[model samples]
Target chain A: MGETSARATHVQHGSHIDTIESVDAVFREQRKLSFAYGAVFFVVTLAIPAMSVWWKSWYAVPIWGGFTANYLFVSLLYYLFLWGLSWTYIKKADALDERLSHMADEIAAATLAAAEGGES
Target chain B: MGNLNIIAIVMVIGLTVFTVGLAIFVRRFTRTTADFYLAGRKVGTIANASAISGDYLSAASFLGVAAAVYASGLDGVWYAAGFAGGFIVVVLFIASALRRFGEYTVADFAFGRFGSSRIRLFTVVMVLLTSLFYMAPQMYGAGTTWTVLVGAGMFGLSPYQTGVVIVGLIIMFYVMVGGMKGTTLNQIFQFWWLWTAMFLVVVFAFTAGKFNYAKGLEEVTAENHRDVKTVTVAELTADDAALLASVETAMSEKGFAEVQAVVDAGDPDATVGVLIPAKNKLHTLRDMFFNEPGHRYNAFDQFSMVLALVLGTAGLPHILNRYYTNPSGSAARRSTFWVLVFIGTFYILAPIAGLAGKLIIDDAWRAGLAPANAAYVDGLLLKSDAIMPTLAQILGGEWLMGAVAAGAFAAMFSTTGGLLIASASAIGHDVYEKYINPDAPEARKVLVGKISVLFFAVVALGIGLGIPAVGLDKAYPALIAMMVTWAFAVGAGAFVPMLLTGIWWKKTTERGALAGMLVGGLGSFFFIIMNILKQLGHLPSEGVLAFVGSLTFPTLFTFPAALLTIIIVSKIDGQLPKNVDEIWMRIHGTASERHEKELGLDKVSTMFGNSKH
Candidate 1:
């Protein structure tokens, strides 16, 4: 946990610290980003099967030579979407981690000072 | 017996030797428990991603998937898509937090996050169950592959039994000796070999076999799909020959003539294999087609199977165990991203092999050029699991068939090796070190871990042998893929809900998570066993019991019910851990990674001894 003290109030890793307030901030931002991507993923994934059952044209009609939209999507195109979704998600997630790492330092210092002032 | 394919056998033997040799080579570096379990946590992003893909792509992906597509059409394609989508759940929800938590195993995560021995033991049980669930299919693949490659048994064991026992023992010995470091290295090497093998099959299909994806689909779908089955003479005649007459329409004159010979002999007890018109499960009013939906599953199963496949991936302890081997939270995400890319491409290729099998194998069968070792009814393989090797034999001759045979073993070896590690840690690390002997020496712990591997390998071997004995092999059209989905269903029920709630929902109490796991895990197991019984004719066809038993994949129900149970139970219990904030910080905090960043622990170049992790 990178914890230095017995009390579980804050985690200290060398010169850096993580107060509950700071982590809560980072968590909210992360939850937003992750859940947003998660929503898209679940929607897109479940949509294919939903289409298979309900949309006859999607499942039955051959758009390509022998390939129905369902076959083409499931066999080949779905993977393209997966690669695209995951690649963009990773880049965004990495960027979020970099930007938030700096913000966490600042937030930790401010939250710690405020907590100390309140205690005094 | 005299006509055994020497080339395929030699290739498989060569692969086993190389795998075992690699494990032995890494044995020296696997001294510490950390090294044995996590490769000392210094694995690079790309290497770790490849290992995860190897661990994730079992015989189910290498063989079962293509076989499924060949038999079930678009429904089979869902397996590849679902397997790949599973990592999305990992990346979006579990990967970073789990890595940030930096625990040894999933059981550790449960204990660490929830703070109780009860939940920890509960998680351990779930882990073992899921691993065993996963192991059963790999063992089945081993047996099936052996039947295809070797075609004979040693020590009076049947070909299937011989395959199960030998492959199980080989994996057990290697995993015990090599540990995680060995498993990791071997997984990377094995993954590339299988990936290349599948790639070669598809490439050969296009070039030598003159297979075109669009044209092939159109050609195969020109007629309604047909199914092959073995039925006793009594059963064939019991329905006033309605079923037998139906079979004549689907079978070729040559194939129907063979069926006629057995019936003409007037042997009531005689069993004959025949081809029959397939029923469209989804669209019962229409005929089943090769390139369309409803070849295998109905409308409900279309959704349930997808959920089972996608959600079940996250629940697999073996796959989740690989994430802990990554160097950092971001590295874990990167590893997962690359994992998606690698396996994504591999999955895309698997279905092509399945589709290719339809065209190439059928042509070969008509020309009398199909492999002699494989049994066929009306040009369709009696056993779809034989499609990969059989198709390869027709397309690229003996060498390609040899490569495919080796690939099948590699898939089983890499996956089973990973499962053994997960199972060992659940028992050796989670149970033994923590509860049985908290202060056990590192060497002793490692020994216990190896013992655990040996025990589970034996159990898995028994399950594989018992599958055919208990009539499970006859209960499903595609046994390997179906059985693997049972594991996925169980894992999806047992783990995904608990992990999702435990990680994302702060109010989640120990009682809630445990209850959720029990509901999801055992609920899935019950439905699966019931379904198996129904398929085996042990259950009546039209009752509540039958209704529940008919759910091929229970994840559609179990996942939601389990999630709701967690929410409801946690709300009622309302007992968060005392150090919830500290735990939350450990899970979501950035100070440590920042600190590690300054110290260069986040680098892809970090070596084993230099790292503090």
Candidate 2:
């Protein structure tokens, strides 16, 4: 029983450290990923209208089914663009939260100091 | 049209009771100004998302877009595409930002930034005017639908106008009683039925109908090539011929001459009548899409529409009001994201149904289910707004038609409720609370909101029921777009400019903000009036002049002008209000209480958090 307890303690320390490390790693990675994702999203959305313009009826088949397919294709791209952005946002949300919280702390300190000085 | 089928009647009645009951349940939440105007700002992401979808998709999307598609192929899908794509723009640039501002109404945001009561009052008048313009069309549509379905004229009033009154009353009641909470709950329910009914109708129409597209095309092609007057009546369908003969005989006996009574009475150049076939309608369709004097259906039109949709979403007062319902900006973002999902799925199916509708009518036309040239109007098989009603009939007969009719009512009511509520809040809370009675507490403000709702509803009813549809069908899209644009301009010019500057730029002055809003608002107004004048033949369509004129100068001109004015004026002024940074911190910060706790801040934090730096 004593041997088991010692083993468990060792494992617990290892896992806890691993989790904390992963959290820090994620925050670091998110800083870079957010910019990259933002760039890609901005590009693709800008491209859709551009393509639709440069080549109006690029897939113009005389058939109704063909037209329907084109419509669905454009709509699917739009939906995918939206969902992808939301996913990217969610992924970096933790890092964003931390950064924003730090900014809030600074603003709060500065404002409180000003208020106290004004009163004096 | 008065012959309501059992299925249609059941569906209609069931939906009516369900919606009314839903309204009653939600009414309990509207006891405070916060509750009435913003659903107490505690609504969940999914709930708010669904409600926003309900509010956004009006009678136009639910009924008119599909009908337009069914009537005119391909081109109608543009409306759906443009509208759905607008939400993407909202998600990217607008949703979270608007939520962060924490205003009760759009005008409040404007005045908050500008610190000018005068600017706020101008916005109040603009809001009322824009809301009325949007409200009138929905009321007109609702009335027209009822008149067709119930044959309301038999009760003495015109069927079209009576339909308007009934729909207007229901919308008013719901808005007045439940406020935003009521409107939100009711919309969530209606959106489901609207999608389901439309989906079922589309599927049924697709599978059950005698649709042979190739044959239909051949028949239309043949009809198009030949002079419509000289078509050979098929000799094989003797029984059908006899039936037609008997009907003609009966009509003649009833003192309606069956014989040739001026087969071509009006000038051939005049607008085509109801009995005209799909072939004849095709001419108008081609002309509308490709040959109209200044109608640009090319990529430029598509892009402009997308731009409108993207920017327009930001400007919509009703949509802005919805963001206030969520507890946090994150929740607002999530809700908006969900709304895109829900709306995207529904819009995907929308065009399919539209195309399917076109197939159904074209097929039926080929089979001679109608008169050689007759179109479906109000299910009487006349050529009018037949695409929607006839498609419903073709899909599931009278039952689906009834459901669609009910859907139409739901669409009208849900949107009108949102508009009325927004308009009411603008009058009741923003204008009344801020300037009229600065110390009116929250409960009194809520009461004022309710009264405002009632007043607007009565006015809606009066205009909807009493004012005859003056040139409704011919100018429907133009009118709807024009009014809706005003709302957008208010949002874009007044609210968006102020909020963006106030939050992001430290050098934004009150005077600059006010000037920006006026420029933006007045610019949109001017453009809108010009468009209207051009439409009414008051302005000559000088090709390049009209083309340049149509670009929403408010977006291009006002946005930059406002930005420039704010920056330049703020620089010249050389001073901002004291504690401006504190206010900026508060507005930019998360929910004040949580934000305070997170930062381990105190009472000073609340002031600093909301104060403008």
Candidate 3:
């Protein structure tokens, strides 16, 4: 009984520390991904104004049937890009969360196993 | 009212009644606070998406985009683009995470995340301010619609004031009774009504008006390409004089005198007439849709407006509240995707409506169906906010006008309803339940919510009635869009930085969030108030004051200030909340994990809970 209690106490402490580290690591990675996505989006969206200001003639160039490059990009392409980025982020973020959850469960199981082994 | 206007009035009244009836029908289902605020968090993906789109497509979008395009051409189309692009930001950074946070209001999320009543209190203020700013525009739009459609006062009130009070009362009733579920249902219907009405107008314009899109483009482009010469006596050579003689022969005595006076002036180069190249006889689409910046925006203006819209969308309390209606984080993400799809489709139709309006007006002028003098057209120009309604009258007569009037009303009602619910939730759920009466019964909380809705409606109505009297209506030609953009700018400046940082950063202390909100909120408010003062002629009209005033949407300055303040203050106050990890876990975890953690359920049971079976 004494051995099991001591082992349980040690595993609980170790697992608690591991959980915090894991959560932080996962969160950091997610934040990095979010920042990367946000930066790319910002650059792409910023091009609308940049083109309007510095490259004035670019807006006049016809890219599609009766639509100028500026018109097509501003009206349609940017929205599609935003949608695509969001879709990709959701997919990847969901997968990351799933992996984190699985890792947490495994750690919890290992801690429980250590306690059981001490009891045996 | 004219027979045609009476028909439109009837349609508007019918729509209001139908919507109120729908709300009453849905009231039976809303027993709990969850149902009242978030429809028990059980809304389906498509329904919620539809509701979001409905809530989003305000009077500004329904009518203002069309008016903007008609007036400013491609520069106007940027409004639609920026609005649609904003949802992208929401989808990426806000939607799912907000849903996962599991809060009734944004203030609730702030309180939960920071564990601070002060932040919650501040959040309530910001949320109410944002929602009121948003709602006021819809109320203004409703008034505009009434003036154009009815053209008279009612019960000793001007048409504008009558419209404000009537719409306010109806919205208050439905929102108080139906809550979020009814609002969502009504919004979906409203979106469809708007879409269908717009679609019908486009179809009619194409079929009846014989709108040749390519030819129209070519003609407009060629006309714009022509070298314009001022029609003055000094500038007029022999050929120009002969052309001016022909133009004078066609003009009435008053018109001829107006032109002659310009010629008589010492400044003979007065812009009496634009001289086009004789070879540029053919009209093209490009000429009609002049694709350039100076018509409406300068370089800085476009960037500021776009930035406000993109960031402001995520910060909007009403929009964020829609996410709370989703069952799970993934569902919120899906709903946002669907919202993009729905709204993207809606925005594409707006410019088409504008193009159709232009063509109709032009054809009317050529066919002698319109008034002979330019003054009437000038009057119409002053009320450019009424372009959509005027177009409906021109293209499809009274019945079509009625349909469009109804659609416009729906747009205003749905947007107002959403804003009311959001404001009420902030006051009732966040402030009243949390701070005022912590142990208040669910029913009492809902009663408070209903009262808040009534209070907000009255406030909005008062502002709407005052707008025209204050000359704000005349001051802003695109009144609906301008007011809506102001709200977006304020929301972006105030809430977006804090929301993004709270969700993504662990070191975001309550003090940092508070500082961010105050700086951002007050900064945006200061700029907006300054601009208003400038408009009222109480401030300088040139230099930096004019430049700042000209921004219209000041998110460019305020958003960065708020974000920087949050970061700096958070770094200085290095103490992280004790429950940061738990909050992160709740926000970032999978459905099964969150369920397990929240309910203290075992993994197997959580797995079962997550499964379809």
Candidate 4:
């Protein structure tokens, strides 16, 4: 079980702290990044079938031998699209996590310092 | 091929022996519940990715994808792409958060996130149901592959029954003995074996079978797509004569003569195998072609199925459980990326094997050189599901066929092993340890987990046996792929909505998650049962029940409906778990990760280390 999840407003790992407000900021950023990529993924994925169903050329007309646009895209190219999307998403996400880790520590330190100064 | 291929049987036996031996060897490492269920969280990125790929790619990808492509054309190819594309959802939306907020199983995540015993129990039921749905097809594949390989029964059991019982028992024994660590190692090895087998078959297709991709596809598409079936004379000659003329047009004279001779026998119930032109379900007016859409799916299904496959992946209990094996959230994300690359390559090769079969098998059959074990109608395979082994035999003969046969069993073993682990954890960890007896010793808990595996394996064996009796094997073309998609639909409906909302939407209440799961999960169950019953002729085709049953995949409707229900119900309820802030930090926070990084705990270690538990 996560110790933080036991009802603390903050999770401290050594000196690094995840205050509720810090995590909320991180959450908003992550949500934005994830949803932005998610929008593209769903659009491209759903569009394959949408076009296959509605557009004649997409499903019917063969561009290379018997490889219709739908057949070619679904069978071959869509994977490249996935590989590209996931690869870039992971790189960006890892970078975001790294950047936010520092920001979260700063925010937590500032909170702790303010409390100490006020008490003195 | 059903004929006694000594080499293929020997290969399969050899693989089985190796798998069992590996399980026994890993049995010593099985100590804590974490070790038993999550491999002690020591798994590396690439290795975990390999295991995840093996767990994800079942007999559905190995046999069903090619068979589906051979049978349904463009729509069939979606099975491959949809499957590989699913990891996108995992990496983007689910993987990192699940790993960070992780426990052992999906049920654990549910309970922890929602903070309730009620939700946990409900999640456990959904987990078990989802596992069984996925396991059913693997069981079916076992029987089908066994019939293809051995061609005989043992101890008075039919060949299919022999396969089902033996496979079920072997997997049960191994999973019980080794636990998750053993399963993870085996999954990595099995994944490579199957990937190599698929690659070899495709390579053989190009080199030995002399197949050219675009040209071969063009050749196959030169003729209209057709379906092969075994039909009784009465049905064939029934009002409107739906099948009589088309049989003649689609079949060769000799093939049609076989049907004609059966008709001339004057037995109304006499069955004959024949080929008939396929109908376009999508367009309705266009002729079905080998390269065109809608041999199996209509427009609604085309979208629904893709949704099910992609979204449903994030919801699968077994796959979700794999995320916990990762050391950190970033590692989980990296593992998913590797998984996509591994499976994407395999998916690309599968349809080529299908296309190769379409181009090569008919010629081999005409030459009277096709493997003798497979049934054929007008040079078309009687059961397209036999394409993997059958095609392997034609291209590279016994050696290649043996490799593919072993690969098929590996697929079943890897997947069923994972599902058994997931199902066992759902009961043993989520139910027994948490609710029944929290103070039980580790050994007792391990025993209970093993017992749970035994129970579910028996259930899976029964499902394998029942498939043939209920005519489910005949109810759909490429039955393995279709059935797996049904499992995906259930997962997508049940878990994706809840997980997506629970992780992403903070306002999501327990009542909302439960309501969403009930509607999405049970709704999918209802629709699937109705669809199966309708296909098996146990339901009417003219009423409201029939209309609901006609939906081939319910994810398109069920997913959104479930999501909306969650929002509305949560809005009305307006209550949240008291520890919501802590839960939020756990889900989105990086302090644990930063702490781990400082202690160098983020670095993955070897699971084979001598420190048991």
Q: In terms of docking quality, how is candidate 3 classified?
A: acceptable
lDDT of 2 by residue, A12-101 (tens): 111111112222332244335544654565466445555544433542332342332334445345577666677567545534655654
Write candidate 4's Cα lDDT for B1-613 as tens digits: 2478899999999999999999999988878888899898999999999999999989999999999999898889999999988899999889999999967888877888888889899999999999999999999998888877777788988888998999999999999999999999999999999999999999999999899999898999998899988889998888766778778998888888989888889899988888999999999999999899899889999899999999989888999999999999999999999999999999999999999998789999999998887788988888888899999989988889899999999999999999999999999999999989999999999999999999999999999999999999887878999999999999999999999999999999999999999999999999999999999888887999888888999999999999999999999999999889888888988888988888898998789775454
Q: Candidate 1: where is the Cα deviation over 4 Å?
A: A1-6, B605-613
Top DockQ model: 1
* Winning model by lDDT: 4
Interface RMSD of 3: 6.7
Instruction: Sort every candidate by lDDT, greatest first.
Output: 4, 1, 3, 2
The C-alpha stretches of model 4 lying farther than 4 A from their native spots are A1-7, A115-120, B610-613
Better of 1 and 3 by DockQ: 1
TM-score of each: 0.98, 0.76, 0.84, 0.98
Considering lDDT, which of the candidate structures 2 and 4 is the better prediction for this target? Answer: 4
* Tens-digit lDDT string for candidate 3 (B1-613): 4223767778878888889998988887787788888877767788888999999999989988887776666677788888888987887778777876777888988888888999999888998888888888888888877777876667988777777888888898899999987898899999899888887777777887676554554444443322222344664434657756654544546545766677667574555543232221112222323554445556666788889988989989999999887766767777888888788877877877776666676567556554221213311233556777777777787677888889889999899999999999998988888779989887898899999999999999988888877767655546788788888988998889999999887789888988999999888988887777777666787888876776666888999999999999999998787767666655653433344345542112210011221
Tell me the lDDT of candidate 3: 0.74
lDDT of 1 by residue, B240-270 (tens): 8988899889988888888989998999999
Q: List, residue by residue over B248-335, the lDDT tens digit for candidate 2.
A: 4323232123122222342323332121122222223332221011122344444444444455666677877887766666666677
Give the fraction of reference interface contacts each candidate recovers: 0.92, 0.09, 0.29, 0.94
- C-alpha lDDT of residue B581 in model 1: 90
- By DockQ, rank the candidates, best first: 1, 4, 3, 2
What lDDT would each prediction earn against the true structure? Answer: 0.89, 0.58, 0.74, 0.91
- Pairs with backbone N, CA or C atoms under 3 Å apart (clashes), candidate 4: none
TM-score of model 4 vs. true structure: 0.98
> Considering summed lDDT, which 10 consecutive residues are worst modelled in model 3 chain B?
B604-613
Alpha carbon lDDT of residue B534, candidate 4?
90
